[model samples]
Target: MKRQHSHLTPHHPLSGAETTAAEIVSGVDLTGRRAVVTGGASGVGVETARALASAGAEVTLAVRDTGAGARTTEDITATTGNQGGRVAHLDLADQDSVAAFVSAWEGALHILVNNAGVMASPELRTPEGWELQFATNHLGHFALALGLGPALARDGGARVVAVSSSAHHRSGVVFEDIHFRRRAYEPWSADGQSKTANVLFAVEAAKRRAADGVTVNALMPGGIRTDLQRHVSDAELARLRARAAGGAELEWKTPEHAPDPEAAALLWQDSQDTLAAKG
Candidate 1:
């Protein structure tokens, strides 16, 4: 009922349908917004797609797999009463996939939700030699945004929500050795580097496009047991799920508890624009 930028999203409990960020946007009508979500077939991505379609926004799910996306798209249509959901092939690991996706997209764009990410996994690199986490989590989205700069600009204003992480505070961006060329690579170290890149990318993009109406903001998705941790061992997951003070160890939110993917589109609406997505 009330909106305050200073008041952070509360996490004690979810009462009504709007309790979560995605749920809060369930009632919102994004009848004209066009959105793209990466790695959106499972976990928080599902909730993200559901909320946007529920709000009437045309959603393009960029995934590495299409079969899995069919299931996700069906669930979205079932919940939203809209068929604006479509799946587009995207392998953040491949530059060709990124390039092809950008080349084919047409019309006025409204929102870009950089929700795709790779978590603590083994060290690897893309074809171009960029580190895995930094590549998929940061560079891929960076390229996608820059590629679609025209669409975002043509619309006059657009919203770019970069889903960063609390892990960012663990370490800042490693400018000189982003690829850890000089150090032995660790899983969490890569994850932290990727998260830090998320924030830095957002801050830089926001500054560059502020005059063009592309207001970028980064926020932590809070702790949730999403498939992003599938690479984690069973024992590691058990520890994270364990409760310490007679309750949950992390006070973590469920997939539903994570911020709704559509909230950005709704909250940015103002008296001046007929559009739902604002830069």
Candidate 2:
């Protein structure tokens, strides 16, 4: 029997919440391709790097801790038997660090996974007075992508994957009070806005870089127990689980509700201006 859903966009046959990274990349040879995975030292980032390396791609772990990155690189190489895995320092919260990492890169980049991110941390601000979550999650990745734009476009057909989250449904970018200067801080709202920014970035970048064949996309890497939940209290976690068990469906924002070219453009400009001012 054939299922019919002509009104909906079809999902990939292999995609599911339980699908592992290895299964997805199986039999796909990436020999000679170069890949970068930020926050590759832990969580889904590690799995992403491993899968890329297993397929014969030269995988670089871009992490804040060089020691952890080196260890992860070693583990991935040992497990995959792909000796091309290496580590590079990348502190997403710091502009200088991002610039240094970008400047140090050489040759064309085939794949870039902006997989590193923070979630639901207490009210914190960067040295430049920007909200911590917004600065690291959105602005940093934005700067890194802009810096690597040429490298990605060099040979054309490069891919940039932004690992966003379902949390984006909680809120959109509050442009007027992006830094939480005037408004009171709430961890989840700040995190949600950053995640929303990630999606908006992919939307705008894909359109802008279409001429250069640099593809960009954002995805929600379904719920997994990860260190990303470090900031969530035990009580909050239990409450979330209870709600889920009660059959409360999340009000997911559809693609039609999300793509705002004007908002994307404004974010791009604002990001550039913010970076310029901070630098």
Candidate 3:
């Protein structure tokens, strides 16, 4: 995908430089609200969970590691004095876990943050034969969001946030062979495709659920060193640094901007049909 340049228009009040999540949601109370943040056990996800809980929302840390998830939830409760935080096991790479999580969810959901993702891993496939990056980063989140539609729509106003990445500019979704069945598997390209899918998923979700008072948004949280980069090698890091030194600035965009609606609708339907077949 080519870069869609914007003229530095500020859409939100907070700049990544100095804005904390607590500061961004200041003055708004989330008491009685229910929220979920996938991958909330560590990294940026932990901060997101803490901020939501701080605002008094009942939060569930959907994590792959139950032990880590429990610890993270405890830490958030201690730091924010919000005891509504809890943990639920979720492995985006596994469909059974997705369904189980959905089944266990109770009551109306006000906020959902599809923040978990895997990046730059070796060529791998889920049990369903989908590419690992696409499966975990996009399709799994897609399924989770759709599965939670009843809870989200129960409330008049709800929000779903997909944490995409600036890497989306590198490539679009490989629709024809999303699993890399017929193409060579390159780490960066796989990661880029997954990120692109995240934005498109949000776009379609917004379009379909707008009438239900549920809005979906995608965001690129400005670069931060986190476990998300665990798969990157020393050589890859040096290469990235070299590119950064050459004046390649990572572009961040608000959720209002995404791929065309046509592409989004197509991806949405494709994802729906894919998941249905698997079921």
| Candidate that scores best on TM-score | 2
Write down the lDDT that model 2 would get: 0.86
Which of candidates 1 and 3 reaches a greater TM-score?
Answer: 3
Model 2, stretches more than 4 Å misplaced? 1-14, 247-256
**lDDT on C-alpha atoms for all candidate structures:** 0.71, 0.86, 0.85
How displaced is residue 95 in candidate 3, in Å?
Answer: 1.0
Q: Give a tens-digit lDDT track for model 2, residues 1-279.
A: 422111111123348768888998999999999999999999999999999999999999999998999999899988999999989999999989999999999999999999999999999988999899999999999999999999999998899998888677666788888889999998988888898888888878999999999999888887777888999988988876776677664543334343566777778888999998876
Q: Which stretches of candidate 3 lie over 4 Å from their true place?
A: 1-16, 249-258
Give the per-residue lDDT of model 3 (tens digit) for 105-211: 98899999999999989999988899999999999999899889999999779999999877776667767877899989988888888888888888789989999
The worst-scoring run of ten residues by lDDT in candidate 2 lies at 2-11
For residue 266, model 2's alpha carbon misses the true position, in angstroms, by 1.5
TM-score versus the correct structure, for each prediction: 0.78, 0.91, 0.90
Order of the predicted models by lDDT, top scorer first: 2, 3, 1
Ranking by TM-score: 2, 3, 1
lDDT of 1 by residue, 29-112 (tens): 789889888887977777877888888889988898889998899988987688999999988767678889999999977888
